[model samples]
Target: MAENLATASYNRRHDLLQRLRTDGRLDVSAIAEEVGISRETLRRDLRKLESQGLLRRSYGVAYPVESGAYESELSARVDSNVEEKMRIATAAISHLGAAQNVFIDEGFTTQLIAQHLPESEHFTVITPSLPIAALHWA
Candidate 1:
């Protein structure tokens, strides 16, 4: 009986992952109903998946985590959305007002923002990313 219960739990979690992959996201209450489980049980399964880095849960929805190995590479991300990222970078810089110091987060878009910042003696840019620091250092 214990073994059967364990198998059932494993099967249910696997099915939940498959559904999240196919649909891109799962509605918590709806999925619980469809899978014949309580919402609490589904929530527990979602939490487990989140802890495993297989999925992320937000509000009442769960989304499968896309493989980050390729997509997260700086070279790949920098080439993917040049125009949109540039526009965002420009907009972000425009809102700086009279700030003498700026903190840029580590990401491709933030890198673009660093590139777009005007050459000014009064501005001091701070970033934790090595690439961004190297770009500005020279």
Candidate 2:
């Protein structure tokens, strides 16, 4: 019985790692449901994976460590947690009180921040990404 349980656990972890690699990120609840396991069980499995440097979990999402040269495309990242990103962006703008210049990084979340920036504010925005620069222009 113990051996069977161990095997089951091993299989679950393997499945999760595989999914994370393919998907780039996994929503915790969605993965738990797909694997037919409780959220708590999945979390435990994720914890093990994190300890092994196989993945990282944040805000109910599991992201795989880059084992190869593979990286998730920006469009895929932009589509994930869009609502949460918008909320974060809205909150982030509040911190820019009376700043004359702002530097935005190259990431989907930063792009949302650029979108949420108040049009009334006359700050000079600087970014290396063309998409973010275009937002300021528009």
Candidate 3:
């Protein structure tokens, strides 16, 4: 019984994070219905996510802390599937050409490219994100 309840809680939290990742933000009513849990229970989950620095609660809504153009939180995006991102970045770099201009977006996957980008004077990189700019400059 105790173990079952703990497993249920773990599943709920995992689902909650997945929902946030897919939707960028969540409303108390919507998430409660989606998770098939009471509002109070959902609030407890939100509180836990907040404590983990994954999200922010405002009024009846919870928004990811790493909100960007895609509405996903930066920290959450970077921390999720790190190895996959690295693999993707490596694949993308293989297609790069010398003496060409490139524009990278601010998405999580694109940020990996910025991190793994080779040091080259031949390619010009343009990005609007300060963090990516810093990465390139560094």
Best by TM-score: 1
Clashes of 1: 0
User: Would you list the C-alpha lDDT of every candidate in the order shown?
Assistant: 0.84, 0.87, 0.80
- Candidate 3 residue-wise lDDT, 1-138, digit = tens: 999998787668767877887898899998798768999999998898788787889999888875332234577577888899889999998888663887888878898887877875456779987788787465
Rank by TM-score (best first): 1, 2, 3
Candidate 1: where is the Cα deviation over 4 Å? 1-22, 26-52, 56-71
Error of 3 at 127 (Å): 0.5
Query: What TM-score should be assigned to candidate 3?
Result: 0.51
TM-score of each: 0.53, 0.51, 0.51
Candidate achieving the largest lDDT: 2
Over 1-138, each residue of candidate 2 has an lDDT whose tens digit, in order, gives 999998788778877888998989999998888889999999999999898888988999999896643334687587879899988998899999999899998889999898888888898988998899998565
In candidate 3, list every pair of residues with a backbone clash: 66-73, 66-74, 67-73
Error of 1 at 51 (Å): 8.3
Q: Total clashes, candidate 2?
A: 0
lDDT of 3 at 128: 86
Error of 2 at 90 (Å): 0.7
- TM-score winner between 1 and 3, please give it: 1
Candidate 1, residues 18-130, lDDT tens digits: the string is 78889999999998998889999999888877887889899999999866421334764778779999999999999999999989889999999988788863577788988
